[model samples]
Every structure is written in C-alpha cells, then in structure tokens.
Target chain A: MSATAVLRVDNLESYYGPIQAIRGVSLEVREGQLVTVLGANGAGKTTLLKTISGVMDPEKGTVKLEGTEIQGNEPDRIVARGMVHVPEGREIFPLLTVAENIAMGAYTRSDKAAINADEEMVYSYFPILKERMTQAAGTLSGGQQQMLAIGRGLMAKPHIMLLDEPSLGLSPLLTEEIFDIIRRLNTEQHVTMMLVEQNAAVALDVATYGYVMELGRIVMADEAATLAASKDVQEFYLGISQDENQRGQRRWKQRKTWR
Target chain B: MDFVQLIVSGLANGCVYGLIALGFVLIYKATEAVNFAQGDFMMIGAFVCLGLTNADFMGLNFWLAVPLAMVIMAALGYLFDWGVLRHMFGQSQVSIVILTIALGFILRFAAGTIWSHEPVSLETPFAGQDLRFGGVVLGIDEIAIIVVTVVLTGSLFVFFSKTKLGVAMQAASQNQLAAYYMGIPVKRIQSLVWALSGAVAAVAGILFASKGAIDPSSGLLGIKAFAAAAIGGFGSLPGALVGGLIIGLVEPLSARFAPDGFAGIARIAPYAILLIVLIFRPGGIFSQTQKKKV
Candidate 1:
C-alpha cells in the first residue's frame, strides 16, 4: 500500500432523524489497498458506507475522494466521479436483463469500445453471467445476484469501491468463492476497496488492514494480521473463547472493556 | 355488411380511447400516479388545435396546426411536472391521485373560460369523405384514426426496446434509487415521460375531433378509457390498446343487437366487463404478480 490515501473520511457523523447512526467516525484507505470494516448488526457499518457513497448525508464530515471534497454530492454525480457503491441487499435492477443492468453501471461513460471490453472482462470473472446475460436479474440465485452486483460495480471502472456485506445471504462455499474474487481483484487488478462485513475471519484473511466498529464508533483499527491474532478479537469476533464453558460470559466482559 | 361497418367504426373509436388510456398507463408506469387530468389534456389538445386552425387566430392549415398543438401540449406536460408534480415527491399514492383530480377540475374550468361551453366541429380535409368497398362503407377519418394508432403504438414499442433513454426510463421505473446510483437522472426521466404522454393525448384528441363535434363534456370519454386500462392490465402498453378495442366492440355490438329494454346496456357495457375481469384477475389481463426477495 502507498502513503497516498485514495479515500479519506474525517469526523463523519450521520443520523436517521434525531437518532445518530454514525458518530465521529474517521478512516482511510490508501492506494491499491483492501481495507475491511468488521462489525455486527447495528454497529453502523452500513451507515458508514451509505454516508461515504452519498446515499445518506452526514451531519458533520468531509469525504475526500483523491483529496477532493465529495460530501453531500448527488449519488449519480458521486458515481460519475469514479467511486462506485455496491449497497447492501444486492439491490440489482430486478426487472432488467443482466446485460442491461451491467450496461446501466456504465451509463456515465460515453466510450462504446471501452464499455464493451469492460463487459467482456466482467464475463471472464463469472462465466455464468454470460449464459444468463439476457435473463432478468431477479431470476438469478443469491450467489449469482451478488456476482452481478459486483460485476455492475466493476463496469463503472471505478477508482475505489465501497462494498456493504458481500457475504450477506450466502452459503459458506459461496462466501469463500466471492472472497477469492475480491482478493484477486485487489491483488491482480489493483482495485482499491473498502469492504463492510460481518464475517470477520474471511474479511481479515483477504484484507491488509481492518477496523472494528461498535455502537457507531471505531473500537479498534490495526493491521489485519495483528488484529486477527489479538486475544480480544479471537475471543469475541472469531468466536474462539479460551474456555469452552465461558463463551457467552467472555462476550459480555469484552463489550464492557472495549467500550 | 352492416355488421362489418359497425366493427370498422367501433375499432376506430376504440383506437382513440386506447390512445387516451395509454397516457394513463405511461404516467402510472413511470411515476405510479393515476393522472386524473389526462382527459383534460385531451380536451385541451382538441381546443388548442381548433384555435390554431381558426381563420381569426393562428390561421394555420389543419396539417400544420395539429403538430403545433402537439408540441404545445408536450411543453405543458413538462411544465406540469416542473411546477407541480415535482414537489409532490414522496407523497402517498391516494394524495397524488386526489391532487391530479383537483388539477383536472382546474384545467376543465380554464378550458371552459377560454373556449366557452358551446360545441364545435374540428374541420379536416377528410372529415366528410367516405370510401366504399363492395357493400360496406368506411369513413376516411375513421381509417386515419386506425392508421395513426397503429403507427404510434409501433413507434412506442420500438422506442422502449431500442433506445438508451427509453431503457433508462424503464430502469428508473423499476427502482429509482438503484437507477440513481447507476448515474441515471430519475427526476428528468419522469418529466420526459409526462411529455411523451401529453403528445400521445394530443394525437388522440385530434383524431376524436375529426370524427365528430366536440364539447367541454367530451372529456368524460376518458372514463371509458380508464375502464379499458383496467381490463387490459393498467401497466401494459399493448394491454391498453387491446382493452380499448374490446370496450369499443362491446358497446356498439350490444346497442345494435340487444332487445328493446337491453339497449341501455351499451352505456354500462365497458364498466361491466371491467368489473368481471377484475373479479378474476385483479392485476388486469396482462400484468404479472411481482415477486420481491427478502
């Protein structure tokens, strides 16, 4: 990873009406780095990604994409600026054919040849999509839909991608398959990524750096290897309590100390 | 031969109703709003074309005036979206329906004030001309309506399938937030849809006026068009055309062939068929149930 940060969020705060969802959060992903944010449900993981993608406005923050402030920009404009967001729930256009759905991701681009080449490149990643290219996206299986959503994001030719829960609603085998692609995309294609996930073990395995969030705040931030080896993470997140009988008890103890 | 003549004329009238119903379907598909003002839009088209072709007014010939009126109506549609409908985003469906109804009344009053309540004929070169084939007679005006409807329907089918802007509109209709994230301007597409619907309304109005005299009350014909939409499936384009034809065939066939007391059935025939179809398929004949994944 380089010293230059591709994406930087500073003192970001967000809310749903009066209740705050993200509070004073700050993070950075350097050039060509894969950073994973690990948090359980309601930890503000999704909210943070939403804020960064301009889907939700932050109460107070500055989101800089390549050192340019992009906070409060329209979502379409944010997409056109080369930052693609694969939102949670794999919200692919259900009624459109797979080809058309992917085409929509390239809506900001005017180069016809480059767009076609990128589409062929996506088909190389997932051959099944090519077979079902003309089929409605809603008919695809869960794993295929996730691949379509990510493929759609890749079609944008983005500098950085903000992915929210790629492992959601998938089997362990499918999750591993997706992580392998994510890892390859980062290492081989050199695509910068900020992934939000609940599956910490797989997330840490692929990411070079990681952040742990709890109750809308960053509880820990460190190198992925170091964080993976930590006793606190092994016990709470990795579910490897030292004492088998004390599994439930250790989580309660860790939560208090971490807060 | 008389029966074939009735079928021919009925199909022609049905084409006009289908065109008006298409305005309802287009707006409903794009914005999920039942625009009650669609009939008034048709009324305005006829009145504007009349004014433009009158010797004392713009004084343009019929051929030139019709297209001009269509252009003006399209602009009015865009203005309606920019000035009124745009602000009503995120409102409840029932409220939007009621708002459109209120708008319909306002447009009707405005039309009445501008053109008065008296009925008038819209003059066309082919208005009184007729063509004979063996024992059957066909009005040239009726043939013109059929031809225009076919051309308009075919063009729309091509537009939605072949054009990028049209596909973008379809994507936006399916999921606004998703389309927005994909860099499509959703609000602008909605406004464009309104404009397209208005242009279609103008063509339908012009065709209807060419058939006979039109009054302020002619806008009531939109009710039957709504029934056509309901029977054909409210969201499907081809469904609107087919539904309109069915309603057209039923009314005339019932009135000419029914016994003495049953002659009154012609007025309620369209609604009665709508009711029966809804009882079996609430989504209309052409609509499919949408499935959402949890």
Candidate 2:
C-alpha cells in the first residue's frame, strides 16, 4: 500500500476474435514488491500480461507505466519505458548466440558504458551464460534457457519485469533455483515484478502479494501468506485437504476449474 | 586461353547473379516473402544509372551515378515496404508472392515507357580497358565485378556479426515476436532489410549495365538469380552466392563441351540444376526452417 505503484492497470479488457479474453482486470504492482498472478490454463492469465506489455491491444482499459498512459503504445515503446516482458514459453531468439540475444534486450538504450555494466550484472546472476557466451541460445537446456530469458530481460535495466510462466516446464529443483533468483532480483536489486504462473505453490512462496484469476476475472486477492493459508487455495490450488469432511468434495472439485 | 577467358567471363556473370540472389535472400530472410519484382528493381536501378550518366542526360561521373542510383532504389525499396508490404504481414506467403509478381509487371511497363525497350550500352571509364596476364586477358569490368562482389559480401557478413542494428536485423529475421520483446522495431527493421536488398540490386544492375547491353527486359535475369537463391537455400545469404557461382560456372562449361546435338542446353542449365536440388534437397542447401512457436 505504501511504496507507490510503478505499473498500474485500470479496467483493462482484451479480446481474441469475437470472444472476450480478459475482462476489466485491474491490478497494481508497487515499487520494490514481487507480485504473482495465479490462474488455471485458460483463465486469461497470459492475455492480461500481453495487454499490459502492449503485445495485445486493450480495447477499453488504461495502462499507466510510471504515470504515463501507454494503452495505445507499441510493445517496443513500452519496453523502452522500462517494463520488460519475459514472455511465455521463453521466446529467446534461437538462431542468435547467447551474448547477442542478451545484447538485443538493451536495444533501445544507447549508453555504451551502462549497457556493458548491465550485461556483466546479468552474467553475475546466470554464470552458466558467461561460460557459453557465444553458444546459440537454442542449445541450452530448458532450465538454462529459462535463466537466459530472465537474464536477457535484466539487460533492459527495467523498472518492473513481467514474467510469464517461468516454471512452465522445469523440474521442481530447477523451478526452485529460478524462483530463488526471481526473489533475489526483487529484494536485492529493488526491481518490481509481476509474475504470471500456474504453479501456485512456488509462485506464492516468492510473491509478496497474490491475485487468483479464474476465467477472465480475479476471484481472490490478498497478501501471499494469507492466500497460501486460505482453505479454498489449500484445497483447490495446493491440493492439500486437511479436513476429512472436505476430502471427498476436494476430489470432486479437483476436476472442476475455479469458479 | 579461350577456356581461361570463359572462366573469367563466367565468374563475372556469376557475380551479377550472386548479387541479385543476395537481394532475394536478404528480403526472404527478413520477411519470408518472395520478391518476384527484385529483378524489376534491378532494371529500375540500371535505368536510373543510365539517366544520370548518359552524355545527353545529367552526365554525372560513373562512380557518382552508381551511388546516386543505389540511394534512389533504396528509398524506393523502403517506401515499398512501408507503404505496401507492411500490410501483408499476416497474409499467407502465396498472397505476397502473387502480389510481388504483379508488382514486377507494373515495374516493367513503367520502365518500358520511361526508358524504352531498346537495348542501350552504359558508358563507363574502363569499358574498353583490359589487363593481360600470362595467357589470359581480363576486362576491367570483369575485374571490377569480382572485386566488388567479394568486398560487398565480406562487409555485409561483418555488419551482421558486429554491428548492433545488423545483429538486431538477424534476430528479427529469426524471430519477429521475440525481437519485439527485446525492444527492436520489427517493422522498421524489415523496411531496412528491403532498403538493403534494393541497394544490392542496384550494384548488380550497374555492374551488369557497364559490362554489356541492358534494356527493360534485363530484369528477367532475376529468374536465374531466383534459381540461384533456391539452390543456396532461401534463408542463407552466402549459400545464395555459392549457388549463383555454381550456375555461373556450369553455364560456360555446358556451352563449351555439350555435344552438337544439344546445342541449346546452356540456356536451360540453371533451371536443370534447380530441378536436381529440389528433388534431392527439399529446402535448398542452406535451408532454414521457421522458428518453433510456443
């Protein structure tokens, strides 16, 4: 509530053909906070991130980045304004070398010394990238590619980073490693973050605040710790039913999506 | 001596083909659209050079006319991309292909009206000069063509590997959406690629014009260059040049050695090689597949 929101979205809506994908989703990520959006497969989670990042146009909402209205702005312009998106499924340029891919992330900025320093900073976090600096990005393992994606995003020196499904296809151990770095980025570097993920358990751990999205709307919003302890989250999202009375209902509800 | 002469001349011809093929591959690499009018762009360049350098016209120096013509063609290319090709982004490759073919016809007619269909020799400072070696003589135009192609290709290779904008263009060619995420303007980069392609075509046209006679129909040479691009693999830049050289070498050899009964085989030699490559290698020699979408 205090630090002043860096990224603010108000009544944002996006569409896919004739169907409404995301409906009136409004959220705020304050400065120096790691926020996560948890949702199921088709809950408009990706659409929300796309709309906020300017990849998809928002039909009737306003996106303000650092108090600048960026609704009709281009994706490249939004990135120049210091909001970088590590898109879903790690869209790293496969043909480009590891170093070149990272260099492209700083394309908008022309400060030579600062960009070099930022690249070194990226190598510090993901040291494996430094070892294979000239290697093509496609050759990296899945977990390493995920790290490269995050490293590339950091090259922008973004005020806030939008991460989509960082844990999508990683092993639990690998996911833990990625999330640790994500937390470090927010706490140590003071870069505000909004992570969109289906891995509720892992996402809730790193996030300070959480929003649970179902269908095209937010069904629940609270602090991360409170949401993790909630009975609804525990039973449906975490797959932990402590009460014997709710066990059968939990089994029946497991097959049903969040309402 | 005749065989060596044939080789020199074949190589010169190949350089022009390679340059045109380079244009095709450059545009193809960035946009995934086949520019059938690439040859017409070459015609326009030759005409532009002719207009500037002819004694009865602007009468600029040969070197001056070359660069001036290239700039005009580059601007035309940038305009075409921004005004026309930009809207075809989401369209299928066939639609773009057909659109470019129609564009070729329009350019041909426009060039025909403005410059006429008569074949005209471009005046150059070194047109009649030659260098004599142990057993073979090389025309200045032939020497210029080889030197220029090698230098241009080498510089382009360096630019893509070393410069920021060049690497960004490479990234954009590989993945448009991902390039956008990196804050690279995908459309602007695409337009720049077109401009670069047009400039390369201008060089090819000027080199060709200085060497021999050229007319409105000279742009038809893009067909052979297209064949060369296919053999090199549509996505690989260097591959297109190599492909062009192969066609270039094979032509003179075929013309010299073919039996009396098959006197006309040299005319169809490039297409024949293209056929073989297609049957054996579906995507060309350096075939680059599309990036897998998530």
Candidate 3:
C-alpha cells in the first residue's frame, strides 16, 4: 500500500453561509497511514471532512485526490473516485432495512460479485447486521447503527475513508470497539483513513500522524507520539493522565508555542 | 337498510379517494413535498385511456388501453421531472410545493385546451352492469374501480418493499444526502418517484372515470386526497387509505341523517379530524416521529 499521497488538501477555505468554518486548512493522507484530526467543538472538524468529501465546496483552496483536483466535485462523483465520507451523525437511512442500507453503499460499484464479497466482509465485522438484515434501520440501537454506517462506507471499496466522530454518543466499551475496528481496518485492509474525532486519546493512540486544530487552523502537526508527549496538548486537550504501555505518555514540562 | 346502501356507496367513493391519497402519500414519502399536480396526473390518465380506446388513437381494448394509459402517464411524469421538477430540485420546500402547483395549473390548462372542459365518459369492460350481493347492490363500474385501486396499491407495496430499485428509493427518501454519498443516483431516483406518482394518479383517474364523467376541473380531486393524507398520517400509505375511507363514509352519512348543509360539514370533517389528531399526536396515528442525534 506504500505510494504517494492519496488525498491532499491545500490551503482550503470553507464556509457555512456567511461564517467561515475552515480557513486555509491544509492536510494530507498517505497510502495506508492512519491520520487523526483532533479538535474541540466548532473547530471546523466536520467542515474539513465535508470539504474533502466534496459535500461543501472549498472557497479558496484545492482538494487533490490521486493528483487530480476534486475540490468542487459533486459528492457522488467524489465517492466514485473512491473517497467515502462516513458523516458526523451516523446518518443511516432510518426507514430502510439493514440489508438495503448496506446495498446502497455499493451504488457506484459495477461488479455485483465484489459487492457481495464486501457485504460478507462487512457482516463479518458486525455480525449483528446479519441478524437484523431485514429489520428497519431506525429500530437499531445507536451503537449498532454506527457499525452499520461504517459497514456502508466499506461497501464503497474506498481507497481512503473520512470518518467524523465515530464515538460520539457511545459508552466507553462501545467506543473502544469502534476504535478497534477502525485500527483493524487500517492494518488488515491497508485502507487509508483520515479520522476527525473529539475522542483525542483514542485517536492519538491509533493514528500514525496527528494534527491538532483550533479555531479552523492546524495548531500542531507531528508524529502521534511526539504530540501526545507535549505539555501544551496535555493541559489544553488530552487532560487525563496517560497510563503505562501507552506510546505517548512522556510529557515535556515546558509549554510549547505555535510556530 | 337503504341507508346501508348509501354507506356502502360512500365507502366505495372513499376507496377511490384513498387511491388518490396513496399517490399523495407515496410522493410525499419520497420527496416530503406535496404535489399539487397529482390530481391533474389522474385526469391525464383517464383522458389518455379515453383517447386510446375511442377508435381514434390505436382503439385498443379496455384492459390493453388501461395499461398503455398508465405507461403514457409515467412517461409524462419523467418529462415533468426533466421539464419543471428538475429545476426545483434541492430548492426550499415551499418553492417545490409552489412549483408543483404551477405545474398542476399548466397540466389542467393543457388538458382543457386539447380535450375541452366538458365532462366525458371513459367506457370500461364493465361499464353499465351492477352486481347484487344480498340486499346491497354494487355497480360493476364501482366494483372495477375498487378492484383497480386495490390491485395498484398492492403492486406499489410490493415495488417499494421487494425490489432493489424500490429499496434505493426508500433510502433516498429517508436521507437524500446519505443516499448520494452511498452512490445512489439520487436525481434518477427522484425522477422515478415522480414517475411512479404519475402512474398511480393515472390509475386513480381511470377508476374515477369508470363511475361517471371527468373534466379538467376534476383535478380538484387532489384536495380531497390531500385531506385524506392529512387524516391517515401525511406520509403514510395505510393512513392515506384509512383517511380516505373516513372522508368517503362521512359525506353520505352526514347528508342522509344531518341538516341540509351537513354535506359541506362532512367535506370539512377530515380537516377537523386532522386538527384534532395534530393537537394530540403530531406524528399521526401510525407514523413514528424521527429522532435527531445531537
């Protein structure tokens, strides 16, 4: 899976009505690498994901996927190009059956056999979906619906997935389960992922590289281990004490300033 | 009782109303926009059937002509998407609703110009016969209307529940943005929904025409159907039917038993019922309210 960058956002500016949500934010995702975008509420994490997935068109910068500019492309076209965005709220079709919701994820794929294989793979990851295949999606518990949302994205056969807040309203155990599945997706399938999450601790743990965003700007960007060690991050962001065996527990006493 | 016969007649009328209401419900479920043109689509269907079997255009048998008319209406629905609806896609809800009303006016005007505004009968296979069951007698044309409505509703239920395309449409209706991300051809599905609505409207029109005469003003029939939708639950299929039946039964009962102007009151009954239901349960009798995650 080693190759040049699969997705690159250069100086992107995005807007929601008159308000600028993302101002000159630039990021990159390399092949098979897990990159995490950590930010607080209203820091434009969702806007960034929307822009990269072509839901919100960039006001200033270019979003290049596989070396082609795709900043202003329609969502379906961007999806067909193999970048799937599992949106912030697990927006599974409430009225649709579980099997129908999964089938929709393969709307662009031409190969029926491959889609079936992917469906099987998704069912393997969340076997509960198989039990509830014909049941209405609205009937599922929140955690199960989140699993279905992820499974639906996988149906796209994405080269890279942009996930927004996968652990929003779940218990600690369910959150861990979600992060584990994400980690396995990255390691086993070698699928590139750009995760935007408020769960900074789990995100930092799993990510190869991390970016801390504040007020729609990237405040810090470094290897996950180094950023996790910074005193500034611990005080302002990752406040909880890191346990032993955690990769990014060592801290610098001195607070770091932005470059 | 002779009163029982009138009640039976009202029930049959309500069934037709239910069919039209189902079209409203189907389109509303798909788009969340009330199609004011739905009744016009019904009128178009009957006129098309009239034309096809009139010995002037193909002159086909009633059964053959019926399916052909539905097909033609479906095609017009596709054209409606390409012509008027496509422009209003993703616009505000009020704008879409207004656009469809404008389309309804256009359709009514066109039908008037081509066929004239006079009442016209569309001959059917069982046009003049009546069947007696016990003391109650049912006209063959009325029975045919009921049968057509039931058959079309069943087919639509199957189409939405069983087919791959149907499931996709349901997915799109629930959350269009998510459906788009999933790679469903969201635009095509919307168009298909419009087409399906048109087909259903045509069937309703044919049934209406079977009983008596239809004219351009017949498009006003959608108002009753809209009332039915409001009664049954605005976006529910079963609700639409139930609502329609309620309205249908009330008019005759009210006219027969109540004061002279009670028929008008009966006409307003569904809305009054809708208001009462809305006060108590905003989500309607059978429908569930959607929950939003923060």
Residue A216, candidate 3: how far off, in angstroms? Answer: 2.9
* C-alpha-based local distance difference test score of model 2: 0.90
Ranking by TM-score: 2, 1, 3
The number of residue pairs in model 2 that clash at the backbone is 0
Q: Write the per-residue lDDT of candidate 1 for residues A1-259, one digit (tens) a residue.
A: 4479999999999999999999899999998999999998899999998889888899998999999999999888888899999888888888889999988889888899999999998899989999999999989999999999899999889999989999999999999999999999899889999999999999999999999998899989999999999877887789887544444454445443475
lDDT of 2 by residue, B18-130 (tens): 99999999998899888999998988898899889989678999889989999999999999999998988788999999999998899888988987888987888989799
**Candidate 2 displacement at residue B229 in angstroms:** 0.5
- After superposing candidate 3 on the true structure, give the runs of residues whose Cα lies further than 4 Å from its correct spot: A240-256, B1-8, B56-61, B89-91, B132-136, B256-282
Alpha carbon lDDT at B238, candidate 3: 84
Candidate 3 chain A lowest-lDDT run of ten:
A241-250
Find the 10 residues in a row with the least total lDDT in model 2 chain B.
Answer: B285-294
- lDDT per residue (tens digit) for residues B42-157 in model 3: 88888989888866555789889988888999888878877877787668999988888988898898889888898888877788887888887778876676676688779878
* Cα lDDT listed for each candidate: 0.89, 0.90, 0.85
lDDT of 1 by residue, B1-294 (tens): 999989999999899889999999999989999988888889888889988886756678999999999999999888898788899887899988998888788878888888888887788879899999999899999999999999999999889877888888888888787787777878888999999999999999999999998877788788999999989999888889989999988999999998998899999889999999999989899984457564
Look at candidate 3 and tell me the lDDT of residue A59: 89
